[model samples]
Target: MTRSPATPLPPPKARRRLRESAALTQPQLATRVGVTPATVRAWESGRTTPRGRKREAYAKLLKTLAEEEAARLAKQEQEREREREQEALPEPKPEPKSKSEPVALTPAQAFDALYAFSAPALVRQTFLLTGRREQARESVERAFQTAWERWPEVARDRDPVGWVRATAYEYALSPWQRFRPRHRHPEPPPADPGDRTLLNTLLRLPPRHRRTLVLYDGVGLDLPETAAETEASTPATANRLLHAREAVAGRLPALADPRVLHRRLAELASNERLRAAEPPAVRGGGERRARFRTRAAIAFTVALVGTTALTARTAPTHYEPPVSPGQAVRGVPHKVAPGSLSDEELELRQKLRDQMQDGPERLSPRLE
Candidate 1:
């Protein structure tokens, strides 16, 4: 018997939205469609197309889900129209503007505002990474400190929250943390048995996989954004995320759904009292650290300049020939006292004394 014709399907994005609207996970839909989760993901990503019976099943499921979604949207719109008609309230008049212009926040003030808004939640997020309450709090504080130090770069960033989150996660998951004095032992486990199991399972994954899971599942970043933040390609990030999910699901099957996993991650993080330091303290510490580094750099530069100057001053400007070593004369006579004179010397002295008066002898007495 010949197979039935393959059913046409909506685009990948529409298929994904339809599945999400139906509250069916990729794995769930895959199970229903008799395919692997990765196959469903591939189909959603448009990497490959399904054929034959599986294609028909997936298309059918998506059609039903899309029809239901359209009906739900229509019902919600109708309810909104009824509420609007029933209420029929006038829109409030615009408030009068003051003559004075609004004040702009200083860099410090803006930094503090961002810190106050983001720190508490970030501290809890880091706790999921390190599982140590103190370390988590410290990680967030240090990230903010770095942000303050590089405030210009951070403020210019399109997503300052992402910048700080990445910094905090890096610090929390640093391998050097294992060698820290405080990290000689693991932190106390959560009181809830389920929380303990979840935390343990999370920690058992490689650091990169754990971070990938937290970014995608815990923090709700999209696949592309998660990939970018983790410095991995989209395909590599998806693989990491899949493996992480499989590992997590293996330990606690209840967390198989990403939505449920997201909620549980929040709950798990919140179980620890991971309180971040005050913004003022973070700001002060950052400023102090910045000042110390600046001063040290200045001092080193000054020392280098001074040393160079001193060497230049003492160095010779022109070439000078070196002195040659001394040597002995080969044919010089020996010295003698008058009482110890030799016979030839005595005879010569007598002849010179005798010939002094003769004019011719005196004139010719050169070497005689």
Candidate 2:
């Protein structure tokens, strides 16, 4: 018997392939198809399949997606072929190295590379901290601009990303921005309601808790790094993270799982990166230096005044007579001798005369 023509792939296999080819997650696909994620998962798992009009619609969507995927692959292949053809052409001779070419990257070059590499993640991390995209962008831009101005110091730092992150966090947390007028309408919300709720809940937490959570979870920093960034001890940072998790779980039960929390944070960070703007150009280093010097001077003055006040308050005070050594030795009574001698003085004089008589040779010079 002749084998029947190969049947089409089952619904589960077809759905899975289409979803993968389209580069869509189950949740993303579900959102586009106006169905729950669990339903999409079930369809992909072969546990269930769409029925009637739902089935027809699902099949049509998958067909369209498959067509789009084929078109994209074709375009990609064409680009690769062009690249291969270019490679086939004879290459131009490279210019000889110049003696003036620096052997190492300059501070500016290093800072520019770092800024380009880190700005997106830094901005995303700041967005997690501040919960405002505009503020996060501004903060990261300012921080990197600072890094550009102080490239030498930042390049020498063990944790340059951490430095930029800390600066961004500081800028995002500034109170002055609260008084500024906010946009009447905000950007469209994230696709995930859970994520939006999680962010809202996080923002309601105490600043320390929020910062610890973002540094640890959102930025993927280790406990010690997070502690250092937040200026908290390790144990304290750990405790804050625990409390922050509990607080978030109270509002968003799904976030109670560590894995889920981590996944969500990764998603949020990635989304923010996609939405972030290019960092602004480095500004006047001189003005920044001047501001830094002014701050240092003020801090030094405050510290000096505080130290002097404390010393004065705690120091011992003692008073001594302003008399000469001779006067002090003679005693005050000798300095104020009476006009008439007392009985004791008379007795002392008689005793002195008797002693002089007994030693007449000693007394001869005075007597003569």
Candidate 3:
């Protein structure tokens, strides 16, 4: 075949790219290609073209650089394709003889784990709310019970611990709970007189203030978190906390420091020796309670409906006049004087005696 024309040099940008790909400066490239650095710059800037031996050498170098770039890109693409294939490969089946693998936890298992983790601390915290270990235990159990009842909502909550904590706190601090005779009388106070005094002071604070102080000073929550949990403004929470601290400090001057107060609160709570019920027990109780309430509601509704129907069916449609209240006498008796007889009645009686001499035909002496 006849000799074909050589390919023209790449554009300015491509020429620069090829040079940079080979990791060579313009001066180095010019030295290798037998040209001045100025000539290489002019070539890369598209201001001039090379010719003869220099042109041929420059073209050869650029072709090598292009081949190297193409090879590098191809290698990278190959590596990416291999990675994709590996990812798409199916996992191998376990052999029968292989040791059994660990199984992931079920929802119940996870819930139990969470309950075990949170319930003890919750009981202690609730004890501080009520100053009664029984109430605290019940509150924690009931809170967990509620959590189990509405577990789906609780599981998806941003903070499940906080959800249960709030529930327990609400239950423990309920105004109605304080009226119940069972919870009204709390267990004995701490053995230490000072400790007993501190706890009494804590219990005597307003419910909101106590809750705020317990969450902030006792539970180590920051002011914002305490406010959020207590459903109050930050300033309100701060104020309550301040008042609670002042009350406690008034009772015991040594607990004036917040850190010292925190420790004292913790110690007071720990000293209560509160214990929580088992998770399964709480869950079962919740289910039973829910069933009982549901049945009661259904029965009440049915009875109400039945009563309404019966009333509608048996009701009188028209007005009924009531019977006359007064009764009438059937007959009147003749009047009789108490001690005197009438003269006319006496004359008529004497006349009848004179005229009464008539006799019957069969037996009388005179007959007419």
Q: TM-score winner among the candidates?
A: 3
Total colliding residue pairs, candidate 1: 0
CA lDDT, every model vs. true structure: 0.87, 0.76, 0.84
Best by lDDT: 1
Instruction: Score candidate 2 by lDDT.
Output: 0.76
- Cα-lDDT of candidate 1: 0.87
Which stretches of model 3 miss by more than 4 angstroms? 1-104, 183-186, 318-368
The digit string of per-residue lDDT tens for model 3 on 1-368 reads 89656657888879987888778988899999988676676687665678877878999989899999999999999999998989878978976764676767877897899999989988888888778888889888888889988888888665799999999999888889867999655677888887788878888999999999899988888776687678666677889998998988888899999999999888887877677778788888999999999999999999999999999999999999999886555696656667765999889879878763774335657676
TM-score of 3: 0.60
Q: Which stretches of candidate 1 lie over 4 Å from their true place?
A: 1-103, 306-368
Residue 16, model 1, lDDT:
78
lDDT string, candidate 1, 139-248, tens digits = 88889999988899899765799999999999898888888899787677999998999999998999999999998888888886787688766789999999999999
- Please give each candidate's TM-score: 0.58, 0.48, 0.60
Any idea how many clashes model 2 has?
Answer: 0
Tell how far residue 288 is off in model 3, in angstroms: 0.7
